[model samples]
Target chain A: MRCEKSGRIEVSNLCKRFHKAGKDPLQVLQNCTLTIEPGKLNVLIGPSGCGKSTLANILAGYDSPDSGEITIDGSPLKGPGTDRLMVFQETALWPWMTVMENVIFGPTVRGEMSKKEAREEATRILELVGLQDFKDKYPAQLSGGMQRRAELARALINRPKVMIMDEPFRGLDDLTRELMQEYYLKIFEKTNCTTLFITTELEEAIFLADRILIMTFLPGRIKTIIDVDLPRPRNYHVLTSKKYLQIKAEALEYLIEEGRKCFGEDCNIANTMVDEFRRQADNRH
Target chain B: MNIYFVLPLFVILSFIFFIFYRQQKRLAHYSGISTLSQIKKTLTSQRFWLVILGFVLTIGFWYAAVYWLPFDAFHRLPGPDEVVIEWLSRDPYYGISIYTKEYYVHILYSTYRATVSFLLATILGVPFGLLMGWSRRFYEYSFPLVEMIRPIPPLAWVPLSILMLPGVEPAVIFVTFLVAFFVTTLNTLLGVQSIDQAYFRAALCLGASSKEILYDVVIPGSLPYIFTGLQISMGAAWFSLVAGEMIAAQYGLGYLIWQGYSLVKYPTIIIGMVTLGFIGYGSSAVIRYVGKRLMAWREQELGGLGVTYEE
Candidate 1:
């Protein structure tokens, strides 16, 4: 289900550097160029310290690139605005506010909708996220999964042009994380809004992305872009599919290579141990 | 026993019982037990019995020290029984008690001074602290001045306050306000600093204006610390209020205590001390209640975790 095309983001030669006292400037992102097509889910996959989050911050206008340009629908972005909303990895739902209040915060603050309209829209969005029962509950009262859902509702109600999710489900348990990935896919399929989702998980990238953009180790840059041609309306069943396995294997190769560069030989030894253990289990079976 | 002593004892016992009954009811609600069973459980609980035993032991020690001890200091001090009787007496031997207009007047004056000082401190301190935390330039310029002045004790300001202010009342208030103001401003500043940077970034990304960020993100984010500061400030206000009152005020609990000493009424001094304790406890309790109401989100967090209540 594709919606109207509006949120097309273009990044050209984006670069950023952080300077520490009495130390040389550390380059975070170097000549990062990418295009997030309107109405598509683009997953940017990378290892830890790969500057993917920094790139996400730059795109969301929370930080500016040292040198480069970012345009949304052919207009250069000036500063943080309602047009680009970010769903942070850490829980950012205002704990003081109830789920309903958090969901309606953007529209109410921006004066984009009337109070009645905002409430109605927020109610619909909460229902969509299956949080209608917990609308009156505070973030502290909710579980991690529910808080993430509430955060998503907070971002979605605004109808932002580009939704930047920076490792949104990074800290969830395995079961909850998978459930959220499936749940997120449903919303993405329905809204078909342009999304730049960042993650370190290869399986998550293959499971949810319309296109997977693999980033190198710091100083980060796009290493490869893999188009996911898997059938839509994705679920856990896709994990065992032949196409899914092929995409995962390919993405794993690049990820492991980058992970090795980032974490050095330690990552390689850990990877080898896992492979050895897998072989032993397979031989027993 | 006299009616005055008997009536007050009954009221105090009833209040304690009421608190226990309410607590049992709440426990029963959470644990799905009958209130009677919960009350029974509470009575039989070792924790409850231990607290009772501890109180009994302390009072027994006090009684022994006053009646049996040979020390001169022990002989001069009033026992718990003597203080309680004198506190409730209609025609008190020391000329201050439940029936005395002077006692009520002293209490009213002290309470009035503390309340005014606390209100003033809050009005000035919160915004000042917010600006200090919000703007880098403001913090750099004003924080040094605050640090320089904060270390000097509020009591140390009494003589200077008397010399500078128009009257004794204003002087007492000024001295009390100084301590509370410093506490509130520092806590509020720390509260703002404690806020996670992620929240600010989220607000900016959500397209909230600077004013909206302050109201929605910064204020709410720093509220837990602000409430904590307010509670501490309330305590500080009373602390300095009593000191200031003792030095300069003509009517206050502090003055009553001082006057009792000068007049050689040891029982009156104990009565004043007990009254001060109850009022100070009540004032802090009010601030805590208001803080709980304002930050219901924090209450839920603490409640969900089953953290025990502490003063």
Candidate 2:
């Protein structure tokens, strides 16, 4: 999906740094350059503490890069706008609103339509997400999967030019994750939206993305961008296909090499120590 | 015993009537004549009448309590009839006059001072709390002072207010404000602090300005706590009013109650106390009603936090 003539974006160099307690300053991102074309799902894949979420935040205009420019349609982006509506990793639907109300939030706030029209659009999107029956139910009443669906409905309801999803399906069970992946493909097909979806899950990236951006750990930079040439209308059955496995292996190889570089040989040993400390704390509680 | 049942019966009947009324209105609306007469016709029904009758019966019970209840130690309560009669025929020698309607007059004064002082506290305390909660520098500088001031009783401030202010009016207002200040401030701060950071990020993502973020997400999200503060501060202000007016003030309910106690006019004291209780409850009910309407989104959360009542 990379445009040859005039594409959607031009990122020169992005850098970010954070101050740490009792230590040297931590560099989270440095001189990362990546350009995304319009109407393609660009999945950013990496391990924990790899600044992938930070990158997503920068792209969504929630965070600014320390230095470097992100230009969309050949113009530098300033801050977050309805132009790039983000679906958060944690379903950030207003806990107070019903499923339908959450979906209509953008249109209502932007004054795009009358209240009645916004509600109609919300209802239509809820139906599209297969959540028509749960329109009046609050977020607490919904399961995590349904809550994610409601967030998706909310994101899609606005019909934004670029839909930014930040690991929206990370915590779900396997069955629900597969179902949501399928749903994502369907909605992407319908909207023709340029999406930047972030996830740590390799299989998920291969399944739904047009091109996957594999990022290296801390001070994150793009290691590779693997294009998925598999046919559309993808489902869980595609997991068994040879093309899917090949994409997964390529992503995993980059991830494994990055993981080794970032966390030396003692990663698992340190994690086990931390896990024991947490277990003791839990017992005390 | 039977009369006690009247209130709940009234509520249930009203509930049923409302449902029926809604159904009929829905029917009329579907048929496409959105006229006032049609809506009114649907509203006027047998169920509505039954509910009204039940409500009237509960009022009758209160009236009866005023008349029939014996004023001996066994009951230790005067009926509304006796209180009314005594109120009407009080001795002129005791500053009693028609215009004075001393009881109602005192009620008016108490209500005016409490409401004014409480409103001042809300305006000042909420923003202070917001600053204290939002910025670490503000919190570090302010929290210790607030902590020290909060536990001090309103009575403790009486000496200072009386010395500092020009008259009893300012003194009373000062005491009332001091009583409400810390609670309102603390609650507002907590309310602001307790809001999830993700909400701010989301608001930022939506291109909300700092002021817009504070108003839309922060204030609305923290309203339940603010209302909880209002509820508490209202009660504190009422309690403080009695002590506040007990100073050089001549015409407030607190003064009236104190005067009644000095003269051994037990009924007048009872009247004053009862009037204060009613005003306090009434004001709190108003706060609760407004809280319910504004924090309509937080009803479930507030309910879970043990503020539940059957609607």
Model number with the top DockQ? 1
Model 1, position A144: C-alpha lDDT score? 85
What TM-score would each prediction reach against the true structure? 0.93, 0.70
Candidate 1 pairs with clashing backbones: none
lDDT of 1 by residue, A1-285 (tens): 233678899999999999999999989999999999898999999988999989988988878889999999999988788778889888988888888988888888888888889999999988888888888888878888889989999998888888999999999999889889989999898888889999988888899999999999988899999999999888789887777766776677688778889666766675775466445444544
TM-score of chain A of 2: 0.88
lDDT of 1 at A226: 97
Position B283, candidate 1: lDDT: 85
TM-score of predicted chain A against the true chain A, for each candidate: 0.92, 0.88
| Predicted candidate 2 versus true structure: per-residue lDDT over A1-285, tens digit per residue | 111222276676799988889998888998888978688888888887899888878888878989998998878898777777788888787776677877776776676878899888777788878888888876766777888988888777767767778899988888888888888788777666788888888888888889998888888888889999888877778887766766665566677777776778656654554456445444544
Off by over 4 Å in 1: A1-3, A265-285, B305-311
DockQ of each: 0.47, 0.19
Candidate 1 local Cα displacement, residue B231, angstroms: 1.8
